[model samples]
Each structure stands twice: as C-alpha cells, then as structure tokens.
Target chain A: MTKVSIHVTLKEGVLDPQGKAIENSLNTLGYDGVHDVRVGKLIEMFIDHDDVEAQVKVMCDKLLANPVIENFTYEIEEGVAQ
Target chain B: MTKVSIHVTLKEGVLDPQGKAIENSLNTLGYDGVHDVRVGKLIEMFIDHDDVEAQVKVMCDKLLANPVIENFTYEIEEGVAQ
Candidate 1:
C-alpha cells in the first residue's frame, strides 16, 4: 500500500489570520527560532482501493483541497521518511 | 514568475491531535453534517529565482515538509483559482 502525503498552504501575500494565532501560541509555548510561523495543512491517506497515486491526486483536486487561497502537493514513500 | 502551491496533510490513523482540536472547534462553531473534520497544512510560494516546479519539489523534500505522518501535492495556475 502506498501512503500519500499532501500539504496545503496559502499563497504569498495572502493574509493569514489563522497563522498569526498559531505563531502567537507558539511564542507563548516557548518555541524558539520561529520568528515567522506560517501554519499550513498536512494530509496523509493510505490507499488499498484503486491506483494510489491517481486517486490521491483526484482527491486533492476534488474534496481534499480548495484551489483558491491554498495549494497542495504529495508523494508516495516506499517505506517512510523520518 | 511561477507560483508553487503545496498541500500537507496527516497520514490516516496517525492520531492527529491538531485535527481533533479543529474538528471539535468546527462542531462547536455550528457547522453541520461535518461529523468529521481533519485539519492540515497548506503552503504556497512564488518563485522568480529558478525553475518553479523543480524548486517546489525540492522545498517539499527539504525544509518545507516533514515527509512523515504527512503528505503533499500541488499545481500551477496561469492565473488564480478565485
């Protein structure tokens, strides 16, 4: 089974109020070197149904993401990265 | 200049603490039929430096992503997705 990984983030110059909150929280939590924190979304799905790669892409285009203020991309790992 | 859109999401069954929080918040916020809400990360970058696509994939591999418990994908729009 191929495990698909996807990340969604806002375009540059896009005002991110959510990110601002997260950054503030991080600071309060004492995280260092994180002068700038832009929070984004990360999705992972394991496919045992159809073509893993194709379906993953399709999901991204359809329900998995919004193409407006956000963007996404993914990869299938043989084992795992980390 | 080319804009790179990237999406990052949690791997299924990874026990997403952050997603859980968001889902709970969504429910509390009065969003209906949303029995499930999984929140992820989204990152969009504009490149005037080099090959936009190439740098995008690299960024995903390097600092832009964790590659574990997360997945990502993206596209290039001639204009914008509203």
Candidate 2:
C-alpha cells in the first residue's frame, strides 16, 4: 500500500482565527519573532487503489478541504505500508 | 517567491488525540461514514532564498513539526507570489 499525505493552508492575506489564537498563546509562552502565524491542515491515508494522486485530489476537493480559503497537496510514498 | 506547502500526519495505527476530538465533533455534526479520523497539520510559506526545498525540509524538522509523532511532505510552487 502507498501512503498519501496532503497539506492544506489558507492563502496569504486570508484571515485565520485558529492561527491567531495559537499565535497569541505562543506569544504568551514567550516565543518571539513569530510573524504571520497562518494555520494549515494535514491529512494522510493509505490506499491500495490505483492513481493515488488523482484519487487523493478528488478527496481533498470533495470533503477534505474548503477550496475558497484553503489549498492542498499530496504525495504518495510507495511501499510505506507496515 | 515560491511557496512551500507542508503536510504532516501520524502514521497508520498511531493514535491521534486531536483527530479523535475532531471525530467526536464530526459525529455530532452528523457526518457519517467517517471511520478513522487522524488529524494532520499543514504549513505554507514563501521563500525567496535559494535551496528552497532543503530550507523548507529543515524548517519542517527543526520547528515546523514534531517528527516523532508527525511526518510531513512539502511541495514548492514556483512563481506563486502575488
């Protein structure tokens, strides 16, 4: 089986309330130099099916993500099944 | 500048606390057919510097993600600057 991983994040200039909350918490934790804290989402799946890339892309668009504010990418690692 | 998108997630059979929380929330949202819910993280950044791939990978390992629990993949989109 091959494992597919996807990353999704908002475009620049897009407002990220989740990220803002995390950023504020980080600042309170005394970690400085953290600018523009935009949050993103990650997804991983294992598929024995074919066309890993195409299938994963469709999954992302259909239910995995919101395209208006987010974008995603995926990679397949063959022989990664354990 | 080129933008790098990183996707991080736990390997299969690995327990995901965040994903479980989201799954419970999704169950409340009435989303069916959701069997395994593993939460992942996504990060997007623009780098004008050379060696974009290497730099992004280093960033992922050093600060962007926890490798012990998460594995990440990144894609470099050239000319993604707006």
Candidate 3:
C-alpha cells in the first residue's frame, strides 16, 4: 500500500472567517504574538497502486479538496500492511 | 514573524467516521487499492515572537487541538513581513 498525505489550504485572496476567528480567540486568550491564522484539512490515505502520486492528485482534484478556493499538495510514501 | 504549521491527528483507538467514509467512497469510486484513511486538521499561523515554537504548542494544547483524542505536531519557519 502507498501512504498519501494531502494538505489543503485556502487560496490567496479567499476570505477565511474561521481563520479570523482563531486569530481573535488567540488574542483574547492573551497570545499576543499571534498575527494571523489559517485553518485547513489534512487527509491521509492508504492505497495500493503503481502510480499513487498521480492517483492521489486525482482524488484531491475530484473530491478531497474544493478547487475554487482551495489548493492541495500531497506527499507519497511506500508501505504495505503487515 | 514566524510561520507555524500545526498538524493534528486523531489518536490511535479513536473512531474516525469521516476517514471510514472516505475509504468507502474511494472503493466505491473504483479505487479498489485503498485500504484505510485518516483525516486530520492543518493549521497555519503567523506569529511575532522569539519563542514561536513554544507558543504554538501552548496554542495547540489550549485551543488549536484537543489533546484527549488528538495529537498535534508543528513546524516553525522564520520570516519577517516586508
């Protein structure tokens, strides 16, 4: 099996209310150094394939991430179930 | 400012319905190779401080992540706003 790690982030210029909320919360909690924050999703999947990277990309582009406001990147590592 | 990337994953033994759904969906989509999947959160923050790493950890423990069911890891990079 192949292990794929996908990182999805909001594209530049997209308004992220959640991020803003986090920033405000941090400040309220007295973490004064925090300037900004952006929240995203990380997806890890195990697959059996010869071209895991390409397949993972297809997964991301198709369903894992929203293409309009989000961008995704992935890393693949080879492994097999014991 | 320092850029911090925090990754939060569910602890072992915790049930992840979302991960299971994704796995089933992949199989239904004809990606038969998929065996298992786990979903997590990725948080990116910009902070201004000399101890960004430690502060980030505090943030994770206090609010960014739930320590009971989630484990978080972070990376810090140094930079300054132009």
Please report the candidate that would top lDDT against the real structure.
Answer: 3
For TM-score, the strongest prediction is 3
Which candidate, 1 or 3, has the higher lDDT? Answer: 3
Which lDDT value does model 2 have at A1? 65
Candidate 1 lDDT, A8-81, residue by residue in tens? 66666777887566445544654322333455666544445345566556666765567887677777765433
Q: List the residue pairs that clash in candidate 2.
A: A42-B40
Tell me which of candidates 2 and 3 scores higher on TM-score: 3
Q: Which candidate's DockQ is highest? A: 3
Quick one: ranking by TM-score, best first? Answer: 3, 2, 1
lDDT of 3 by residue, A10-81 (tens): 998899899899999999999988876888989887888888887888888888889999999998776746
TM-score, predicted candidate 2 vs. hidden true structure? 0.58
iRMS of each prediction in angstroms? 8.6, 5.0, 0.9
Assess candidate 3 and give its TM-score to the true structure: 0.94
lDDT values for all models: 0.56, 0.65, 0.87
lDDT of 3 at A78: 65
What are the per-residue Cα lDDT tens digits for candidate 2 across B6-67?
Answer: 66668666798876775565456544323355777765555565677876676677766787
Off by over 4 Å in 2: B1-14, B17-37, B43-82
Query: What does candidate 3's lDDT look like per residue over B1-82, in tens digits?
Result: 8788889999988999999998898888888887768899888888987777779878899998898999999987779562
Ten-residue stretch with the least lDDT total in model 2 chain B? B26-35
Q: How far is candidate 1 from the true structure (C-alpha RMSD, Å)?
A: 10.2
Report the Cα lDDT for candidate 2: 0.65
lDDT of 1: 0.56
DockQ, each predicted model: 0.15, 0.24, 0.84
